[model samples]
Target: MVVRVFHTATALANTLAADVARALRSNPRLVLGLPAGRTPIPLYDELARLHRAGRADFRRARAFNLDEFVGVTAKHAGSYRAFMRRHFFDRINVPKARVDAPRGGARDVERECARYERAIARAGGIDLQILGLGLNGHVGFNEPASALIARTHRARLSLKTRRANAPLFGDRVSAVPREAISVGMATILEARRVVLIATGESKAAAVHQLVEGPVTTRLPASLLQLHPRAEIWIDRDAASRLRGARAAALRRLRRSRRGRSRGRRAAARARGSR
Candidate 1:
């Protein structure tokens, strides 16, 4: 596990975009697993900028979203599919047919999950999976008690997830669906690479636990620790709770960057003075 701490979300976003661009260049057919939430908004915008500038190409890439709320119409603003379209697909050049997500609002949720899993398999599996961590350490919609489901399937939402996602559905917890379809732990762990994005002090404790704690069912996101290639990118606020030595080292790295920026400015001023 590699932890990179940035001073601000904007810097983190830029860094993530650059890494994504590098991934695309290395593998044009990269199957990207996308996440939806406030955490990745800036990163999506930055990727769109790269696409517009012709620095990145997503036309041949395929995308699969992590999860979607059951019973929510895809046209609804609260739907994860809508969220992905609004933040990413609509802005980038990914082919519409190649981008797939589980069908929400289906009469048979189980069948939909099965079909979605099969589609991913037919497309050659995901190459890189991007994720957003919930404050309670849930990833996708795999809540705390769902350690048993080893394959892709539908899930009943936990109370904590409903509460956390309430704002997305007109700020009413009652309006948030009680269930969702998510790509399972096995699917995410199967990816060639995994990138988890988190921000804000509200996520600090959870981030610390997920990054260093034991891989347990209680902290579902902690399962990433078992992945062979997983990277976590977080801002300083979200990394505040890491242990002493690690936190101190991160601070020193930030300070070093600041010092270099200050030296550059000082040199520019000295030239002007001459």
Candidate 2:
């Protein structure tokens, strides 16, 4: 697990876009697991910018959304599929055929879950998975007490989650679905790389729990600690509660600068000696 702090959300988004662009350059066929919400909006915007600049291409890439609300249709304004289309797919070159999300309105939800899992397997799993840290520390709707090693499945939405998402449903808590289908913790852990983005003070507590607290189901994002290549990017506000983490990041930054300075000085001295 790696935690990186940026002064602003835009900076964090830019850095994440650079990483994603690099990954795509190295492998155009990369499979990306995406999350929808305000936190990743900037990142997707940045990627769209890169695409327009010809610095990135999504034509051959595949995308899978992290989760979808059970009662919503793909065209619903509040659906994750609609969110992705509005924010990413419509802006990028990725073919519609190559993008997928859980069938939130499927009559056979259990079968839909199983089919989604199989689809991921057939794609050889996700190369990079993007996540947003929920206020409750949930990831992909895997709410608190979610099994540590579960696979793609249906889950009941917690009331807190519904309330938090109420604004998307026009501030009507009753309008938010009470259930969702999410790619499980086990499925997310299978990704080659995972990037989690958090911004603003609203996310500080959850981000702190994710980075510094114990690995427990009570804080689902804490499970990222077990992922081999999990990277967390947060703005200063989101990292406010992690004073020790902030200090450590600053120290590392200083050390890196010192190392670069010493190398340049050594080169200058070598030239003078010559």
Candidate 3:
């Protein structure tokens, strides 16, 4: 697991977007696991900007959303399908047919989930999965629990999650679906690379737990700690509550940067003096 801290949201977005572009360049057919939420908007926006700049291309890539409201369809204004189209897909070159999102409105939900998993296998698994940290440390609606589901499955949404998504439903928390179809924890862990991003003081506690806390099913995100290739990107506000070695390491990194800056300035001054 790797943690990257940025001083500002823009810095974080730019850095991560560059990383994504590099990955896409490395594998033009990269399969992506994407998340939907306010936290990832900046990154999506940056990636779209990168595409426009010719720094990245998505025409050959495929994408799968992390989750969707159980009873919702693509036509719903607040559906994740709609969200991705508005925030990302419409702005990039990726074809609409190449994007695969769970069919929450399918007549046979279980069969639909099985089909989604099968589709992933046919595509050779996901190359990289982008995620967002929930206020409760949940990942893709895999809420805090004694044990988490292992594959793509239907999950009950926690009240907090519904409340968080209320704005999408016209600020009526009750309008938010109480259930969702999500890629399970085990499925997420299987991805070749995982990138979880968080920002703002509201996410400080969850970010702290994700980085320094114990690995338990209670906070599903802590499972990322066990993944061999997980990258966490967050800004100073989201990293505010981290402590112990994690905190010290960030401090040391800052000091090293300052030292390098001063040394470069001194070298330039000496050269001018000579």
Candidate 4:
């Protein structure tokens, strides 16, 4: 795992969007796992801009949302499906039918989870999975636990998440769904690559925990330690706690590399002049 810390959320979003755009170029039929929340809004907006500029091609791309609230119509204003449509799929060229998300308000949730998993399998699994970490280090609603589940399924929301998400539901905690269906940790880890974006000081503790702490299900995002190709992009505020002598030393090493590269370029220019 690697961390790319930016000074602002917008910069982080642009960087992440550029990475996704590059991935699309390599594989036009890329399957992306998307998350819906305030964190990823700027990223989606930047991606939309790239698509409009003809720098991104999503015509053959497919998307699957990370999770959705139960007990709500897909058309509901606060639904994840509505959030995805408004923030991403609506602005991009991804076909409406190819953008898959679990059906909410389904009387048979077991069938919903099964069918969602099967759909993902049929699509050849996701090429890149984007994620947002919960305050408790949860990833895609797989909250703190002693063990991680390995498939798509429904989960009860933790109190902290419910409280934090209340404002999205008109500041009515009761209106927030206690349950949501999420792609499991195993499913997320199966992606060819994964990108986790986080911003704000409110996310500092979680970021520090997942980056430098133990790989325990108690902090679900820590499972990334086991992933071969997962990267995290964070803003300065979110990385506040990670600042230290060791980080400063690493920064010095990076600057040294840049200085050497610049020196080599100067020598090459001098030779050309001669």
Clashing residue pairs found in predicted model 4 = none
Per TM-score, the best of the predicted structures is 1
**lDDT of candidates 1 onward, in order:** 0.89, 0.91, 0.92, 0.89
Candidate 2 lDDT tens digits, 135-214 = 99999999998355389898998999999888789999999999999999999999999999999999999988898889
The pairs that clash in candidate 1 are: none
TM-score of each: 0.94, 0.89, 0.92, 0.89
User: Of 2 and 4, which scores higher on lDDT?
Assistant: 2
- lDDT for each residue of candidate 3 in 1-274, tens digit (9 for 90 to 100): 8998887788898898899999899999999999999988999999999999999999999999999998899889999989989999999999988999998898888898888988888888889999999999999889999889899998998999999999999999999999999999989999999999999999999999999889999999999999999999988788888898778766776777789899999999999999
Off by over 4 Å in 3: 252-274
Residue range 153-262, candidate 4, lDDT tens digits:
98888999888788779999988999998899999999989999889999999998988888898998998988899998887778777756535744665567689899
Could you tell which candidate, 1 or 2, scores higher by lDDT? 2
TM-score of 4: 0.89
lDDT of 4 at 265: 100
**Rank order by TM-score, top first?**
1, 3, 2, 4
lDDT of 1 by residue, 215-248 (tens): 8988888889999899988988898899777689
